[model samples]
Target: MTDWWLWLYVASMAGGTMLFLAWWARPCGVPAIEYQVAVAVPVWSGLWYAVLALGDGRVTDPGGQSVSWARYADWTVSASLLLVALALTATHALPRRHPWLPTTLVGLNVTMIAAGLLADLSAGSRSRYLYFALGTVALLGIFAVIWGPLRSVARRQPDGLHHAYVEAAALLTLLWIGYPLIWLAGPSGAGLLGPTTDTALFVLLSIASKIGWGAFDLARLRGLARRHELALAGRP
Candidate 1:
């Protein structure tokens, strides 16, 4: 995690963010939030990685593990934004987004992230496992909502939009599973892996989940907009 590993991630993410903005011709009729998220996720994660690269935002826990709690901070904000972006896409076909589902999704996301953070912070204690369990429960709830209720919304979408929603949602959920598995394997939980390896995995995952994922979603949305298949915000 020390050397060019994280710095390269920062360069890719930050550079990509700038390049995406520079020659960016956002397709017409796409929601502005699409562009906003396309930029925000990478920049935010890169900033925190920059912080880690600069040797800040980290503390050695009692177990002698260097904990970059800033990664948790990064996840909290960026994952929330990602959830909103996905939620918008999920409900894009609906005439009006019910306030409850989006709000619940966000709440569950925050809870899940917060629980992971707490689990990491409470390392060397039994409660860390409890926190992990709670986070797992929250994760299950998220799955139920997205696959059950949100999938229902997807059914109402045009074919293109439905496929986009499925792609984004399924990838997101699958990618998310890697984090906890790594956490359990890395220095934080079972110590099967070292900190450097842990950090490297997180960096790669962030790149894929944020930068790569955003590109796919936005590209799909852009194509849908071009085809006049994307549902606008207010119109029934």
Candidate 2:
């Protein structure tokens, strides 16, 4: 079941990658970096999905569960690109403080994924929950960065960037809440749900978070660019 679902997910991601690339290829006037980063999100995730689908992604966890380590790698990179796209869209992110806030956001995202991976890999319950707690903390840090400094940055921007950032961040944060919840209930944690159900939840979440969210973001930003309300982002 896992293999079958993973293969299906790989196909979905492949299709999403092609669609995202095609969208990016169009002469949208949005910032090239944002569009390009949006494209990279699915491309990278698709490749990792392919790796897992090929049956090379399984690792025997200390809990004797078959885990897909590649999924963690995929999340780390793809989610970071998502953050980059968000930062590029909503903030001037350059020529000041080395774009520390955006970098900090990405770092927090990576930390969250890494900790989740470590949690799954851990043998003992104490170690696993410890890592889970760390990941949750990192996730909170991400939210803080978003609602804190990133919000402040967004508010100062013109061209409807403030509203855009708030909406995008809200969507992303809402979607992200599912990950740890699913992980906690799935085989990796309490084992309240079976692996197949866990995979299904994750797959659905990935589809919505990556492809759906990316489309919404790029499309809205493109509309803003067309109206000449977009600033700081490079126009075609």
Error of 1 at 212 (Å): 0.9
CA lDDT of each prediction against the hidden true structure? 0.80, 0.82
TM-score of model number 2: 0.91
lDDT of each residue in 1-236, candidate 2, tens digit only: 87787777777777777776777687466656776777788788888888887878779987689888999989999988887777765674333432787799889999999999889899899999999999999999988988888787777777476777788889988998999999999999889999889988998899889988888877777776666733455544
Pick by lDDT: which candidate is best? 2
- Model 1: per-residue lDDT, tens digit, 66-153? 7788888888888877877887887776788666777888899899999988887784569888999999999889888888887787
After best superposition, candidate 1 residue 105: deviation in angstroms?
1.5
